[model samples]
Target: MTVKLRVTQLAQLEMAALGGIGLLLLAAFFFQLVQGELPCAFCNLIRVCFMLLGSGLLLNRIYGINPWNYVLSGIGALIGSMLSLLFMFAKALPTTKPTGSAILGLHMYTWTFMIFTAALFFCLVMATLYAQRDSLESPGHALDARPTWHKGVIALFVALVFANLVSAFLQNGFDHFMAGGQQHYRMLYDGDVMKP
Candidate 1:
């Protein structure tokens, strides 16, 4: 007997979480490039977490691996969200000493604190959903008809990734792009830096 499911609880959630994160990453990068805000190592790490978590959710949709997919998303969300929060605290703590150029009269840490706070919130939401999610029903319940917002988010994510890719390649020349250089950006961030 062959059973089919489309809009299972987990799948719906994966879509929503991925959409939110995707929109955020896109918005963040565009804001950075347009506003001339630079991403410190920590910011970039958080970005990577968004990308990984987004990817994991996407993979879940296609692969239906269930446990691994949700687990990966949850763990990534937990770790990445926490990492962003810690960076926020570290940056905020040093403000008492006072230093560095303020962008638009605001310190970089100020920007990071806002970003991390939002990311943490989303990560928490995704993690909780993942934990409670047990099964996936067919996608027909809600997704079959296709909601307008869902489509918008998917389009936005594609746009964000495409923009990020092009901007990344052009700025860094495809290698050391985000490092404010042009040789080793694609090599992935160093692990030591990820640890607190």
Candidate 2:
């Protein structure tokens, strides 16, 4: 016998996947704190894309699953893929140095490229599946009644978004522009540079 997931179940699964993505960011932040390695501008942009993707997933969870949610997330993944590709090629050049230490033989940008591509595919598939189903609400679970873990996931996503914003400000200052290779926070040391 074959079993099919209801729209609600699929949405919950997607949200869980997005939560995993959020944890990935937290892991990235952990590496930054422990290893004293700051992300470059490209890396930051990729992270922003990830946040955008998460935002789309959040919308679907809160407002109900829609094709537009997948579109929003797919756009983010597409942009992230392009940025990761550029970053990878830049690092691949003979003159340019790799930004962070490689994890499991592949650089972070390489992993991000793979991740974004996968996410794009995932969004497409989920959207198609969502389209195939005719019903929006399932009798199994009420949309209003969310599990505790679901709430945690949303909280984590929100926290990560705020943390990323603050980190960017701290690194690039009010002007939001800084050299990618700089080791120290421009806003912290350069008092005059903070002025726009």
Q: List model 2 lDDT by residue over 74-157, tens digit each.
A: 999999999999989888878888778788999899999999999999999888877876756443444458888888898899
Compose the digit string of candidate 1's lDDT tens values, residues 36-64. 55454555666666666666666655555
Worst 10 residues of 2 by lDDT: 135-144
TM-score of 1: 0.57
Model 1 scores what on Cα lDDT? 0.56
Task: Give the residue spans of candidate 2 off by over 4 A.
Answer: 1-5, 138-144, 190-196
**Per-model CA lDDT versus the true structure:** 0.56, 0.81
lDDT of 1 at 125: 60
Error of 1 at 115 (Å): 8.0
TM-score of 2: 0.88
Distance from true location, Cα of 40 in model 2, Å: 1.1
